[model samples]
Target chain A: MATTANSTKKFRHRVMSAALAAGVALAAPALAYADGRVVVFSPPSTDNYIAAWQSGLKKKAADLGYEASFIETTRDQSEQDAAVQQELAAGADTAGYIWWPFINAAGTNSLRSLSRTGKPVIFANQYPLEGTESLWTAYAGIDDFANAKTAAEMLLKACDESSTVKCDKGLIVTFPAGFSAGADRAKSFRETVDGKLEVLQEQPAGFTSQDGYKVGSQIIPPVKDDVTWVYTQNDSLASGIVQALTEVGKTPGKDVLVIGGTCHGDTSDLTSGHVIGTEVQGAYLEGWYTMQTLHRYLKTGVVKDGKVYAEATPDAPPSDEGDISRYNFIPSPPVGNSKEAVEGFRLWGWTMDELCNY
Target chain B: MSRREIFMDVMFRTGLMILVYVGFALFIPSYYSVRGVAALLDGAVVIGLTGLGIGVTMLAAEFDLSVGSLAALIGVVTLNFINGAEVGMVTAIVLGVVIAGVFGAAQGLVIAITGINSLVFTIGSLIGLRGLALFMSGENTVNIPVQRLEETDFLSASVLGIFSIPSLVMIGAFVLVAAFLRYTVWGKEVLAIGGGRTEARAAGVSIKRAMVVAFAISGALAGLAGAISCVKLGSATPLGFDTLLLSAVTACLIGGIALEGGRGTVTGIFVGLLTLRFLVGGVSGLGAPFWMQNLAVGSLLIVVIVAQLSVRQLKSRHDAPALPVH
Candidate 1:
């Protein structure tokens, strides 16, 4: 009787241990699934470039085994603050936040609100004002000054190639007056080409093809014969300048060289030689690095606040800033006038087809 | 109204338009050139259409703030139908305009049923429709397929060296709307309703039907403008027509359209649009800074309103019976 009772007790103990093992196996996958969540606070997804950037970030985050979500904000600051509050209330174990502030000054309150949550907030695209670094973990975006400087350099090269059109006088069809990015880009272009080139006129056209066409039509007819090169803020504006120049009997790439400051809109202009060249702002790289940084912060619990260079050519880096920056500076290279330059351009592992999905 | 008063009123409104053109022509020599005039007309076509739409609503004692959003929405929708749904350009445009008109009629029905102010109702739609536009286009500019663009190329084609198909369309719309407002019994009922809703209702006018028809017409015209602009641009963006609302309202007011409804002419609205476009194009051509252009527009709006008020006050006093005592 004693032997039988001992055997029964051993059998019950074995059953309980197997059941415990099975439960542990099931909970392991669930734990892995709930590893960490990354929340991205972005502006309205209306812009093609912004949409592309978000898509890249989401793709990278998913690849890195992190659950990523996005919250969109309008131009209103109060609404952004409310969204942040709502996100914080509903989220748990939030690894970090990727923030793209729409307007710099109005975005400070949003930054302050996010800072109180003790989660690292990564500011992308628009750089905030100085002394606001405490509110964000780091900044990641195209250096507009560098971008404009690159455009100036390209314009100078184009002028040097031609003998008839001296690089002395040029026209700048600018973005709106007070916008920080436009202001910085215009200022940088002027400063870089101050002694080398004489800017004939700088007109502040709002950032649209229509506005560009309007301003270009008004200014191009009068200045067409005089100006050597036209520097537009983006390809959309560059296309407008081409149209206006055509209307005035001037060929864009022939009579006057047109430099699209950024590569956006249809790339057919680049292939057809309407736009001489443009700078690749590395939007995809900016997004990929943003996600990678978030994953690193989650794993290490240490934020490395420094520039990241994800460029096409490993050898050619931005000459202005050497590899010794504390903040991440993604590499933005200039594409030449040839179709090969556009087709051959690559960032990290992604091709132009993947980068410019818009 | 005496013939002299009528003539003076016509001169007062249209005279301002003529003076603006002459002033720009004199000061800015390039403003008189063919290219300059063509550019002005090209810029005015879209806004002029929107202004006419708003003018129609104003004539019926209603305001359609959703015209701008409707324009953007319709443009995006038309492009989507062509690109995403693979529909023919003509079919897509007609479908887009019809859908916009239906939406407008629905809003009118809501206003009629609930007795809500048209302004408030359209303001809600303005926000909602903009949101809907963004959603429909996924917040990007929907590009029309290259093959489909040839069908709509007439929008950009110059017909008479100075006029494009878009400009002709604007003119046709203006003439059609003017004739409709002047000849039809429904048009007269709309005017009467605007002048005095209580009296119109007492006289057995179909207020609900007239309001719905007026709003539908406005929506269809706005949609047509959007479709034309989309073809011209070769793409349709969700926020492309953001500035249309303020500009259209300013054009209506400057054209001597009564804000309280019951008064305005299509010809006057067209002239007002031309004046505004000339000011914008002329100032930019003359090297005026961006801020100055905005200031000029704002100042012009305020000056017109204040001057009209002053004139009305003077006329009322002049018409008052003479005092009995010294």
Candidate 2:
């Protein structure tokens, strides 16, 4: 009788273990299906503007009842590919992906890898290369040509009003060479102001206020008397230019007209009248709309093609296939020296304070 | 080691520095002005400090490639302590320096125990420490309020109407390091070890202890440099000092420091730092295009290294013993 009872107890234990294992196995698909996370492949997390974009993306994702996560990549293209591969291997049920392609041409491998995941991939910040659109669902960012044209026009207008400085000669302090946006902006600015202005010097001041100050200090002193206007690709560089000019006893607005091409941070220069004008690059709105477009595609089973969105708003509903191109351009409005202009600025429900303050 | 050799070395380096200054003054008129000199010296402070640290390690026959990363790490830590943790400025600076020294000692201990190549070990530390900095700072630029920087802004202060506090600090560091190497028994032992580890061991020197101390001093100086830069910039950025390691190494090489170890002068290093800063400043002032500026620096460095190598070969031939007449 004791042997029989022991056998029965052993049998009961095996039965319970088998049942538990089978239950977990049955629920595995449900757990996998429930994950609605959107992964953002971004540049190094240290960049202030990129951080702001991610923050906006996360905020928008949360509001839409979806979870958002980020995978940091070094500027190296292979590193970006590796990061995407590692994420995919984890087997999470990802809703979609946002790719910020660290280097535009070098990022083709990353795009191809994400395409294998069979999820919609939205190219953010950096524009994708040609012939790689099959892998990318849509491109959402500022139009580099239009943005540069706007900045050039602003500088021309400033030059026209100033009586003391000649409108014919100017200097451009731009981002480092080989950067797509920098190259585009410089080309467009030169073309737009071709006959109107003669570019005395085009220097790469980098994207930091310190570099800008150093470069400006070195270049401005010799031409302090002749140069009419100084155009910087960003506000940090513009602020640096102002500091360099001020150190030499030259008033920025009075001695030389300064324009910050992109207003991303520290609008004090704009507000204080150091810079004559700037434009809203809408970094936060870019991140927000990338996710929004991805969410729409996932919900509606339709891809919006060739439609250019303005001010982070989708102009048309999702289409199956139409005359829409692959590119979607976000409208970036210009901001002037007036306090009212700055205060009244809004891009996709975000005020300047929210977008500019990282 | 001969007096004539020593004199030639000093004169050669000093003469080169003077030539560079005169050249810049001729090409870029503004480079000779008081403000231009001030700006050049100001720019040299951080690189000079880093070069000094590299000089120390090179003197001890060890290579610390992580000096730049260590400086960046300490900068981040010091700023975070003062701004984020609300630690007092003095306490934060002291703590940052101490931590850096300890980190150096730990690296020394690893090299001492494992007997690994100092270059490889420190290269690993270089990569690891930069990642650590990024992690600690959340990969963000930490901005300190301008008011928070005022008390510790001695690095940027003008001292005697001619020199800034940072220039003085660099000078003071050179003096102290020179004195220590000349007067201290431990310093003598470090030189001996660099001359030959086997010979040093036979001569009753504590190789491990001396190396650890050298590394500690190097780390402390790097930390101080980072602190100065933090105060000067009023912000600590993750990649702010990325150019530091290359600049320091270039300064050392240009200063005539023997890469194989054990031979260099603080004075030579100082002049080298000044020469490099002037060259960069002068290039920019000359309105050279951005690409041209980079090409010029690269070409100059290559020429210097090749010239130094040619000199070494010639010196070796001169020192070679005469063959016995048949």
**Model 1 interface DockQ:** 0.01
| Residue-level lDDT tens digits of model 1 in A240-268 | 88889889998778778899898767677
Model 2: DockQ score = 0.01
**How do the residues B1-326 of candidate 2 rate in per-residue lDDT, one tens digit apiece?**
66677678778877877887876665443466655566566667777888988888887888889988898889889988888888876677778889998988888877888899999999998899888886786655565653454455565456775478767887788888878877899877777788788989999998988788778877887887786666455455554466678878888877877788877777778877877777765554432333444566677778777877787799999999999999
**For candidate 2, what is the total of clashing residue pairs?**
2
Give DockQ for candidates 1 onward, in order. Answer: 0.01, 0.01
For residue A77, what is the lDDT in candidate 2?
A: 36
User: Please, what are the lDDT tens digits per residue for candidate 2 over residues A1-358?
Assistant: 9999999999999998986686666545335435777878876656777777877688778877777767764443333443554455345577888888654644554566577788888888756655566778877777877888999999999888877666767799987543557767888999999988889998876777897899999999888777778889988899999999998888888788899988867888888888999988767776776677677667776665566755333234233223323577667778898888888876656677776655
Ten contiguous residues minimizing lDDT sum, candidate 1 chain A: A317-326
Q: Is the docking of candidate 2 incorrect, acceptable, medium or high quality?
A: incorrect
Chain A alone, TM-score for each of the models?
A: 0.80, 0.82
**What are the models' TM-scores?**
0.51, 0.51
A19, model 1: CA deviation in Å?
99
